[model samples]
Target: MAALRAACYVPRVFTPDAVLIERGAEETPMARRCRERLPDVPFTVVEDRQAARVAIGDDFAAAKRRLVLAEHRGSFLGHCPAGTRGLRCCNYLMMNFATNCPMDCGYCFLQEYLAENLPLTAYVNPGAALAEVARVLDKHGDRRFRIGTGELADSLALDPLTDLSADIVPFFAARSNALLELKTKTDAIDGLVALDPKDRVVVSWSLAPEAAVALAERGTTPIAARLAAARRVAAAGYKVGIHFDPMIEHAGWEEGYRDLVATLAAALPAARVAWVSMGALRFSSGLRRAVRARFPGSPLLTGEQVRSADGKWRDFQPLRVAMYRLVRRYVEEALPDVPLFLCMETPEVWQRVFGAAPLGEQALGARLAAR
Candidate 1:
């Protein structure tokens, strides 16, 4: 029965080639779970992250196929990097329990950001990370904050092994000042649906057209599967967040997005949706090179993009604003009650799309946190 149960729980979302446990992490809850659940995968212990990287080699693509459970040094929390001086930022706080995602989304910025730390890693000490979060939330008790776990990695991608959500969910469920947003492109929510969030958590999915999913997002859950998983999550009492982020401009974008909105409306209950967001693809030179080398045939590279004030390449103001407006209209018409926002956009683009810009990130953060 023990063997049968372990076999039944083998992860269907991803199968790592190897499991690397960092020094002193071999006895961690996350490492123990990986040992039991990933029975067939090779497991090894290294001196530290550097040694693990050497063992994993320098190939970023190959490194992504391995899992590393290591100690997370330094502060685990920070502001979202996309909130640049010129962009009308959402004051989104980020707490990273992991540094890289296993999914190889061709256009992901982490391909460039995590070039230094190559392997897909989950921190072993989630308790310390949670304690840090509690301190921050308690210190800033007056103002509301929206904290997310998906900034550095897909929030739930390695959850089956790490069981990070099982710990973080109940922790946030007890907090009153902030909302925990678990964002991901995968349908790895088995650890999530079992937890009770007490309206304190939001499980957000990055919704994209199947064309873009096929073109750029490799190894992610299908749109249908993601929606079905989200429906299951909502049925368990957690609010849902929909993100049409990096909304790739493709051949039939308008029609594709319209279909996406219609499908999302039919599948997800509107009452369970807390927010909706859409942003056009924004690229940096580093990310562009990564995408070119990794996904040479990608249609994401075909768009005529210009460098924005934030030093990232994006569709010109008018083009992205139009994309936002159209997608916003579709979502609003379909699920009018849900609050919709833009991700990593400028004040001018916000103004163009909504007729007004948020007073600032603080005001926007407070508004979203209230929901």
Candidate 2:
């Protein structure tokens, strides 16, 4: 977690040349960090979020190249793990501290979730929003909540610029009923590691094989580097979470995944890992054409897919189960007793993999809360 050759050293990723600052966000800490990171990047004060959008342009892909610092007038905290029918929900709370990610993965749902052409926006007033989160936690004192910041964006992709972890990690550390999970794909952990929050903070990484990383997940840290960073985080006294969600299928996939699991196990021991989650690639119908167009020849789009009851296109049941089982086997071999869960999967799939499932969403939430 020490500073590297350069502060902002992510290769082949977008570093904003221009920052569109909304009126209310100009003096906030998040905006100040952005300005400090890119000292030469020109800043234009816009009247509102819509005007900030105007400053970017009409092309969604093009707009991602710029950064927009705006006041998030909307709620920052919400029900965790937004559920779809037929899939069991985890009930983890979702924290929307940012809107979009700088990394351009082929299967990123935000490409279709956020408004096209809108520049990535980080809420400058997280302190206030976190106050609201505290109020909610205080109201439900008897219940435990696991909240994460990666639902809408890679939590730490822009952390070097935003320094959000310094604010969020400490906030969650003081709360007894909540655990703040900063889920990301980048190695930008220097600022986070420096803070050294207590055990309530979970540093998580989204993982895939080298082939899948090279083919689809562009502009993120390689799997080896990510595991290295996770080791550093664990050494810094924070629990780590690993995710293999959106596991893609391709030739030589088994060997590639086995190597990945082995590498992770070598990097960190089971006691440091809070949980591991396996999820197969699934997307909405609208994203099918988007992924194909954005990442031409992506194997993600070439899989056998069917419209599930939830209305999203999923890989065939047997195919998904096979992918999950393979990953589960490798992961269990590495860290047998570490808690492993399936993300957004059906009860039948759960039974097939784990032999038993949580009784309900509340039960799942309680189990994860204990972790």
| Best lDDT among the predictions, by candidate number | 1
* lDDT by residue (tens digit), candidate 2, 114-161: 756468888888887898898899999999999988888889887888
Q: Write the residue-wise lDDT of candidate 1 on 1-371 in tens digits.
A: 33332333324457789988887999988899889988899999899999988898878888888999899989999999868768777799899999787777878899888888788888999999999999998898987889999988999888888888889999999999989999988789988888899999999999988877777777777788789999999999899999999888887989999999999999987888989988878888999988888778677878788998878888877788888889989988999878888888877888889998756778877877877
Which parts of model 2 have CA positions greater than 4 angstroms off? 1-14
Cα distance off (Å), candidate 2, residue 158: 1.2
Shift of residue 302 alpha carbon in model 2, Å = 1.1
Task: Score every model by TM-score.
Answer: 0.95, 0.94
Residue 28, model 1: Cα distance from true site in angstroms:
1.2
Best candidate, TM-score: 1
Candidate 2 overall Cα lDDT vs. reference? 0.82
Score residue 355 of candidate 2 by CA lDDT: 82
Candidate 1 Cα outliers beyond 4 Å, as residue runs: 1-11
